[model samples]
Structure formats: structure tokens, C-alpha cells
Target: MKDGDETRQREDTPFYDHPTGGWGSLKSVARWMVKGRPSPGVLDTLRIQNKPGGHMCTSCAWAKPPNPHLAEFCENGAKATIWDLTRDRCTPDFFARHSVTELQGWSDHDLERVGRLTHPMRYDAASDHYLPCNWDEAFAGIGARLRQLDPRSVVFYASGRASLETSYLYQLFARALGHNNLPDSSNMCHETTSVALKSTIGSPVGTCVLSDFEHCEMILFFGQNTGSNSPRFLHPLQQAVRRGCKIVTFNPVRERGLIEFTSPQEPGPMLTGGSTRISDTYLQVRPGGDIAAIAGLCKHLFALDDAGGGVIDRDFIAEHTDGFASFEANIRETGWDGIEAASGLIRADLEAVAEIYARSPRSIGIYGMGLTQHVHGSQSVQMLVNLLLMRGNIGRPGTGISPVRGHSNVQGQRTVGISEKPELVPLDRLAELFGFEPPRDEGRTTVDAVQGLLDGSVRGFVSLGGNFARAIPDQGRSDGAWAGLALNVQIATKLNRSHVLVGDGTWLLPCLVRAEEDRQASGSQTVTMEDSLSHIHGSVGRRAPASGHLLSETAIVAGLAKATLAPNPRLAWDDWVGDYALIRDLIEATYPEEFKDFNARMFTPGGFYRGNPARERQWKTTSGKAGFTTPTVLSALGAEPGDAVFTLMTLRSNDQFNTTIYGFRDRLRGLEGDRMVVLMNPGEMARAGLHEGQRVTLVSAVEDGKTRALPGMRVTGYDLPDGCVAAYYPEANPLVPLGWHDVESKTPAYKGAPVRIVA
Candidate 1:
């Protein structure tokens, strides 16, 4: 903690070079909705957000367009709907004038700008503040500390802002208290695109849609940053670059919303600032070089299908795939100088992006969390599903493989039953539709729930909404294991630093947000989510509940499952919290082949499409087809970077989203106030003797003798990719290392992490 002691302030600026949803995204949505003044019925609930019975635009999941756009949301979904309909608040005399050790020295954008979160407080470790408490005494002291633990040591988690009837009643109140653990927020970003697309296309989601960006023809991107993490996917890449398609991208920061944008709803390119260019080839690659740039674009599309050049779809790979002769003999025995020194490009630019994916007849591929964080992030998402199944591109239409997800129903909280593995959910149909027996062991992933709260084997934490101590990853070893918890709950709507990191029985509990109005007793309710193309919509809110003492994440997971289970009768839990269509008829009796008719295809319009058994090409894996894996590490940082190291990665700045820090500007890399800067590469900041704005520090190349580092950090430079760097994410999440990650989806490799800088 040295050189100008970090808690913000590093102004730098210059480098935005414009064009991303023009008029600077309508003046950053009119200065973040007049700095979140919200609540004049929150501008009439932003005119029913993604429309059709209105509501689902609690930000990034990017799908909702089925002929929509009378303002079909964007600009960080209007700063996450004016940071969730703000009107300030915080209450209980603002946590009795701040104390949890002085709001732990504030600044996570001033700890969620101290707003919303109205009552249900608790945590007074004798005057450390947070008083209010009631909803049945914080659910009888979090159900008497989860009835003396051991329900697999109690964790729960669930933050894709709840809803599929409060994540099936918070994973059926943690598998009827017998524990299926259920960690969430997609186990920290796309759990390696769900463990490498369910082992190469047996389906773990994303087989295109949103009219496959108007019948593709080409699109590629990787290590995604779709104009600040899916800004409503820049109006389908500006109508697929005005109908000619062709994009391409790869990344190590050539991102300015994929190089050009414009549509603040297109009024003649917002009065002729006329833009729409978007990556007609970008390629920087490097930090964990996406498995050597997806195995050098599947070895130059297998040398253009062995020069016969019909660019392989060899009759849809001889009848819909499976290994392809040891994946074309491991891409013709690899080496093109180890794919140009682990893909920092050049082989005639990967054979000119494999001749624009062999003269595009349809493409698509998109990606994010820079090809899923790293340590070979599930073999770079199974080598981008073996370059979209070498052209048989997973079941037709403008091609497949998307990923671009950032919360907003984090893939519908892993498709309605959060998960901590147990064979990717369905525990014998939720133990015969709720009579019990659901545990099935394996549970705990948010890096094994912060190594089970620093190894006392997790004593109890609940969560429902996120900000889990500023989105996990060794923040001073998870805030010194959050006060050695014996129980800590959250169920939030604001007041974040994981609700004042308290313990020995905390509580918080402020719910109701997807833009308000929840009501119950058989009336006004309507939830459901799921995007990132597995579709299935319906949202509902329409203003008015920022506080009436909140509550409705299905009535606080059915009043904490009627204050911790024991009533059963097939789990009525107060008639599924007074009717959420009886929790979508027990989530269509625990997934009847994916909620068949769950409430008559939920509000239709742009809402239903839940099918994707490998996009109807069927092959739900175990060799029923679509396979081709062959990876053995092409470059998940197994080498290079010997000079003052680097490879950093973290990201998320266009005014943040995931760990929700909505300001400290980052108007597409031109920075602003600050979030501890970094971004390097002006010749690696003069080979790390650093300069431009230098405050330096970083550290963590982890041998674990402790000392993670991340001091002042300023740096700056830019046009990245030479041994790379870049920062912003829970402020470089304390230089990472919570046992690093992604050795097959433990996830944390927050884009690569190896750090070094120093000075």
C-alpha cells in the first residue's frame, strides 16, 4: 500500500477515439440517469424495458430483440436501470452513520454510492452499526445458524439477480437443507462456458439466435468486449455491419466496442456521426493467448481443408462429427513456430483469419471473459468448440457458439437450479418433485466457496443477490474469511461491500429489484429469465418497491424456507410464496425436458426458445457426435513473459457491470476519474521501467508465500498485446490467486493473472 496509496484518483484521459453507440451513448444515458435520481416511477419504468409485458433488462445477457427497439435498452442497460431504480436511501439512519470499520475504508464507487437497501439490517457486534432487523428476526437468526450446520456446511450463493421463481426457491432452499451447495453467478463468469460447452456440444448453451445476427456470413470475436460487455450487442453488430457481415476480432484490447458503433437507436446514425464499422479484422491476442488463438484458427482451417479448399464441412464432417481422426492429427502436428509464439499472431495473420473463415457462407462464434478466464480455460472453451465444429457450425442458421454473458440471469441461474455440480442438476428430478433426498454430494465452487470460508469448512452464508464481498478473488484473503462467519446472510438490493462484511451472525436482507413491483397473494408476480440465447424471457416489475421494506426474491426465498424447513407437504412454502404460478408448477415438475409450457411459454413475444440439444443437431454428447477436442495446452501461459513478467487481464470498464461499479468513467478506454488504472504496452511501458502515469506495483506471480500486492497501480499506455496487461475488475481483484483457477472451471483465472510491474 504505497506510492500514492490507492483509493482512487488517477485522471489521465486521452485515447477514446470515439464511435460506440453515438452521442456518447446518449450522454452516458443522460449522465447515468441524472446520477440515479430515479423514482418518478423511475421514468415510468423506462417505458417497459425490453417491452412485451415489460421488465427484463436488468442489464447484460443480450438477447431480447425479436423486432424490438423503441429503446430496447443499452448503455449498460441504462446504468443497470438507474442503478436499480435509485432514490438513494440506505436507511436505518444510514447504517447508523457508517461504521463497519468505517465502511471498510469505502470506495467501490463509494460503496455502491450509498443507496437503496432499506430495512432488515442486523449485525451489531456491539455498536459496529447496522441495526433495523425484523422480518421475523432475520429469519430466526438465519434459521438458528442453519440448524447447527453440516448441510454440507451451508453456502447457497445464487446471484444472477434471482427469479426463476427465486432460483427455484433458492435451489429448493438449499436442497431442502440437505445441501446441493449451489454456488452461482455462473461460478464466476461463464464457468468456462459451462465446462467447455458441455464437453464439446452436448450443449451447455449458445447456439445462436437474435436472428443469428441477420443470417451471419462471418463474425468471430473472441475474448469478448462487445462494446463494454454486450451493450445490447451493438444492435446486432449494427445490423451485421449493414448487411455485409464479415467482422473477425481476437483480443488483447483492440476493443473500442469492437472498433466502431453508432446506433443510439440509429436515427441516421444519430444524425450522421455515421459509424457501423466493427472489426473487419482486429487480432491482438496474447494474455493466455486463447489457446494459441484457438489453435491458430484450427490450424488454418486444417490447411483449407487440405487445399481442396471447400473449407471442410466435409459433408458436415462425415455425418455430424466425433474426433475427426484425432482432430486432424492434432492440427497437422501443430508448430508454426508454436503457432507464432503462442498466438500473438502472424502466419499471414492466421492465413488471413483462415481466409475469412474460408469465404464465409455463415459464421458467428463470439466469446467473452477473454475466452473464459484462463489456466487453459477449459481448453479455451474446447478450442471455441473446435472452431464451431469446423464449419458444420452447430445446427445451421447464421452459425453458432456465443457466450457473451454477464449476469442478468446468469444463464438463468444455470437454467433454474443454480448448481454445484451433482451431475449438472436434476437430482433424480429434484428428489421426486420435493419430498427430499437431494444432496448428491459435490458442492462449493466460487473457488470452493472461498476455500470454504478460509477452511473452517464454510459455516453458513446465503447471498441471493451478489456483491459477495466485492465479487470474490482473494480480497485480502476474502476479507480475512469475512469475520470468521458462523452465519452471514445477504439477499440484497444494495449496500454492498458484501453488506458490510460482518459475521458471527449477520443478516442484511433487502430484496426486490428487477425494477420493482412484485406483490403476491395470487396476483402481480411474473419472473423467469435465461438469455445468452437459450432464450426464455418474461420479466414484469413496472416500478414502485424500492422500499416498503423490500422483500420478494420470492419473498426472501419463502421466508427463508419457512424459517429453515421441517414442514414439507411437498414443499408448499406458503403456496410457493403466494403464487409464482406455483413456482412455475414446480419448475415444470423439476424440468420436464426444460420447462415444457412453463406457464404457456411465458409471455411469448421475444421470450421463449429454451431448446438447444446441440441446437437440434441433437448429439447430447458422450460421443453421440460433435466432439473434436485434442488440446494438451497450446498456451495457457505455460511459457514466455520472462522479462519483468506481465500477462495481467482483468477488465470491465465501460462504466462497469459485473461487480457493478457504475462510474469512474472508462468511456471506451479513455479513462476518467479512475479505478486504479494499468493498461500497459507502450513497449511494455518501456520494458517495465514504466512511465506514463506510473504509480506501479501489481506483484502476484504467485508461489503463495503470501503477499499478493496490487499497490497504487496507475500505469496507462495502451494498444496492448506484447506480453500484455490491463486492469479494472474489482480493481484487479487483489492480484487474483485464490488458488488461481480454471483447471477445468474452478473459474477465477480472471482473464490470466500473472502480474509483475512493481517499481
Candidate 2:
């Protein structure tokens, strides 16, 4: 029941009351640096992060400002850099000291805390340990195993950590093996955003540039926690607030960063302990209620416009959009009673938000995972776009939809063709550039990949970089399915649960981290990353690799491809790995529209923005106009919770980023050395006959005949909606059923999980 370190008893913990991003952030950064004990040049490596001709921060994909501050990275960014640059190494000796079973007994945190992987390894089932293996033999064995299975039965999963060049090559490698089963980290996070935005505005990416915040009169946040997920974004929000911009937030939890923020870079705040108020209005909407809340805003806006308030942009809607009449009718037909019940907010609050929208000539709507991980996640996104469209928010300066992406290059990965859906990518261009007929069939998504494994249809899984076993939903089913795979391979930088959960033909190929230099046969190579706003920039690693045995991701992919497929006269895998510029040139050839002058544009100062047609009102939809759709469902979780049931939403701690747990201390949440605690509303706890600090188990309310329960969760009363509760992710991922996902996007419903507290 324990996870290495002792969980801080509830009696010893108090709620954090200080502002976000102040002295607390500095202390956390220093503590992490000390704990990680990064190499001597780690500080200098951080200095170039998000800077021109320097490596990008391996943290969130928040765009770097045109003129970045001297110390541009955030506390979490420092942790990620320090974590990647750690002196500790998981060597062959570490594997010799413990078997896979013994390592499985350790916490996720403990496994990674041992530090970066130092050598290539292949699992020896007889010895129950991973023995060091040369790259050649490992790739040969893997290629042989892969060749034995049907390409459709194999899954290639990638994390956002991979650079654009690496991702592009990864997809080509998969298709060369004869399938398009490419699923990346985006499938689990922002897949809904892509599906919805493409259907609505004809572009999958967000329309807002970072500078839009400065010019916007109002910024509305839904479901995103800026402080933890995208801390660097706080600078723009802080600046906007200083200029008297209106900031409104709607989330289940009252995040500290949305309430107030004190920038560490601000000398006045650091010296005087002053903090800038962030959200002028904070609404605690229920989990999975974003769609209803957005609908209410639209309804109120319609009412205002009907009364001749000059709220609706009639000219823009008539000129640039379609289905306005039906969209307006649906909004008007939806009763306030239903909206209030589903949203967990009164009509008055929505009206107030509508008033703010009406007053502001320019506005931006920002969202994150909170809105994306639900059964109606796609609909929720559409609703937000619908609300923006009512006021002609898109295709204008200081106004657009912004989905805060999690990983540094998650958006970039998708841009360079890491996708399951074949139609989303340019197949003709890929075939022309690579001299191979690419697969046209729809590939497997993360959810379908897990399903394929459970049903014995999938024989292999290859992850470019991610904690695949830990990050996926329904851990009980997924972990078992992973261990039963015919082949499992992880191209990674560090030790994690995924690497140890070995199966047949399992191999661990260590790769150079983001902060390390990636010198190939030609010369030192620099990879490019696309930020959330479509800005493409170069990232050239400066520090030495953690181990001499480490290979660049590009090299690893090339080695695997060369080993797997018979050499084609035109395909030069080794050549592409030797000089990345060649890879970029091919990328430009593949997507001339997006990556035109790819190599030249990537190194430009602050990078160039690949223009979005939606941003220019050049609608690429089938009807040649932005379309508005109506959502019939009021609640993402379906029916309302009966008696003891509560809507459970999983979230990340301040000490964590995605699935990587840096340490047990969550500074903003006031939890030290613990992550198994759940936050609940005081009234909700009292209603359920549970006291503060009560140790209880959470049982999934899904009627699947599966005993999905998480025991040993300490209850802590906090500020949240009355019928909603929050817990840390990956731990709570088991309670979320694999089938419970957005119907359109197939994104697992991690936010609106129905659960009941049991003693």
C-alpha cells in the first residue's frame, strides 16, 4: 500500500493560501535541483531553453514569447530539465541488483528517481532481468519479431517529447512496415480539440497566438489550470491583468494560478510579496459540465442580441458561417433549468459572463485537459467554438480558441503525421516524397490500441517516449494486456513502469534526452518543435549525452527501420539519420503547404507561424464556411449521480507533469510526501457522512461487473463543487473504463468518471 516514501498524515497538512509563482516556486525549484543533483552544466543548459538556436524546454508546450525573459523557464520546467540532466543513471548494475518483479514493486516515482537509462537492454525472461544488449542485436531481434506479425496487429505509439523530425521519421517507419497504426500522446489529451475544431473551423490547432493575450480585452478560461499545466502562460495573463483586462475562469476546482499569481521574475513581487489578482470571476462548474456552461453563455448572448443589445456579430455570421438559425434555435430551446442543473451554476452567473463577453470587443477562450477527457469532450469543445462564433471571435486579432497543450511538441508531433486517422494526413504527398504507397486505412488510436491488445488482435507495441503502461486508462486490463503482448519495445530516456513490464521480444533502447547533444555522422543535429500556436522553432541540445551508448531518437528509428524492412533503392534510412537537414527537406516535400522551407524557417528567430486558414477566415470545410452544430446532451456523464455517487475528475499534482511524478510534494495543494489523497467539497463530504481526513476507497459506479476500486485514498475537504471530487491521475485512471470515452474522438473519459466513496 505504500509508495516508497511515507504519505504525510492528513493532520499535518494544511491548505496552501499563498499566491502561485512567488518565493514558493523558487524554493521548489532549488529543492528539486538539490534532489536531482543534475550535472555541472545543467544550469547553463536551462539558460538557452526557449531561446533562439537553443533547445526547447521539455515541459509544457507553452509558446515562447517573441522576447523571452532571461530566466524563461518555470519551476516545473526546471524540474523536468533537472530530472533529465540528473547524474544518477540506471545502469546494468541496477538491473542486476533487482529483477523485473522486484522493480514492479517500487513506486512509479522510485523507478524514475533512479534516473536516466544508461544502456540498451533486452529482457531476459529466464533471469527475470533486463540484460545489456548491443543496439544491433536488439534491433535485429525486434525486427524479426515484428516481421512475424501482421503490420495491422502492431501499434506504434509516440509521446509529445519527440521532435518534429523524429516524429515524421517514426510515422514513415511504421508505414514502411506496412501499417498506419500510429497513436501519439495527443490521442489521450487533445484529440477532442482536433476533432471538434477541424469540423467547426477547418483547422485542428488553436487560432490564438501568445501575443493575442496582450491585445484582448477579456480572456475566458474553461477547465484549464494555468499554474500547474502551463506555468509559463502566467506571464501573459499577468501582463493582461496589469493592463485592466477582464479574466474569467470556469473550472471544477479553484486553481491558485487562476485566482492570483506572483511572477518570480517580477522584482517588486519577490521583494514586496505582492501578487496580481488573476481571475476577475471564478465559477466552480461541475465535472463534465463545460458544454452546458458554454451553452448557457450562448443562450444568454442570444437573449442579449434579441433585445437589440448589439451583442451578436450578424454581419460576420452571415458572411463567414453556416447553420446559425438552427444553432440559435437549439440554444433558445434549451431550458435554463436543464442548463443550471447540468452546469452546477445559476443563470445569473452565466448572464454575468455573457455581459463580459458583450462588453469586450476582443476576447480569447482558453481550455486544457479538463474539457477534453470526457464522454462528451468533443461536444464540449464544439460548444466553446460555438460560443466564440456567436460573437465572431475567430479569424481576428486578440480573439480565438486556445487549447493549452501539455507536452512540448505534442501538437508538433501531430503536425508531422503521427496520427491514427489516414484522412488527417496528406497520404499522396507522403507516398510521393518517400517513394512508397502509404496505407490509406484508418489506424488505431490509443483507446483502440488498448482494446486491440485486450482482444488478442494486437501483437506488438512500440513507444517512442511515454509511460504507456501507467498513463493509459483501466490499468488492471491494460497492464495485463501489455504483459501478454507478443512484442514490447520502449525507445526512451529513463526507467519507468513501461520498461519493466516485459513480455515476449521485449527490448529497451536508451536514447539521448532533450537537453543532450545529438551528434550524428554528418555533424551535430538540431531538431525542431511546433508549439501549441503553430510556431515552429529549432532545439539544439548542448549538454553531453547521459551515456555514450545513448542514440538519438532519429538514429534509433533509422536502425529499427533498416533492420525491419528490406532495403528500398530510394529509401536511405541511414542517410536521413546522419544529416537531419535531409529529413527536414523531405518533410518540406511531404507537406509543402505547412513545412515550406522547413529547415530554413525553423531556425529563424522565434520561429515562423505556419498560417492557419481558419485564422484568416479562409474556411476549408466542405461547405466552404465554418459550421455551427448543436449538442443534444446536457451532461457528459449521462444520467445524474444517485445518492452516494460523485463525479470524479483526475488531475495532476504540482509536483508532477503528465505521468512523470517528480516528487511527492504538491506545493500549491499543501500535500507533502503524498499523492493518494482526494480533494472534496466540505459540504459534499458531510453529505456523504464522511469526515475530513477519512480513509476511504472509491468504487467505480460503472455497471461493467468489474471491481474497479482504489483504496487508501485520504479524504481532504477543499473548495470544489458540491457533488464533485478530485484525485491525482494515473492512480485514478483504473476507475475509468476503457469504453467510457467520447463517441466522436475516442478520448477516454478521465474527467467524468462516476464513483462512490466507501469505507
TM-score of each: 0.35, 0.97
| Regions of model 2 farther than 4 Å from truth | 1-14
**Model 1: colliding residue pairs:** 223-370
Candidate 1: 10-residue stretch with minimal lDDT: 1-10
For 1-759, candidate 1 gives per-residue lDDT tens digits of: 111311121222246767887898888889877887877776667767887778887777788876788888878887888888878878888778778989978876777877888889888888888789779889887887788878888888877867687887888788888887788877877888887888887778788888878898888888888788777787778778888898888887766788778877768868867887778778777877777777777788887777788787878877888787887798789888888888777888788887888888688788888777777788878877887788887788888888878777878877877888888788888887776788788888888888888887888888888887677887767777777888888888777778777866888888888878888888888998878887778888867887787888888888887888888788888887887887898888788777888898887888888788787788888878888888887887533576677778888888888787877888777778867888875676786677888797888877769988888988877767688687888878888888787888878888777878778
lDDT, candidate 1, equals 0.80
Clashes within 3 Å, all models in order: 1, 0
Report how far off residue 70 is in candidate 2 (Å): 1.0
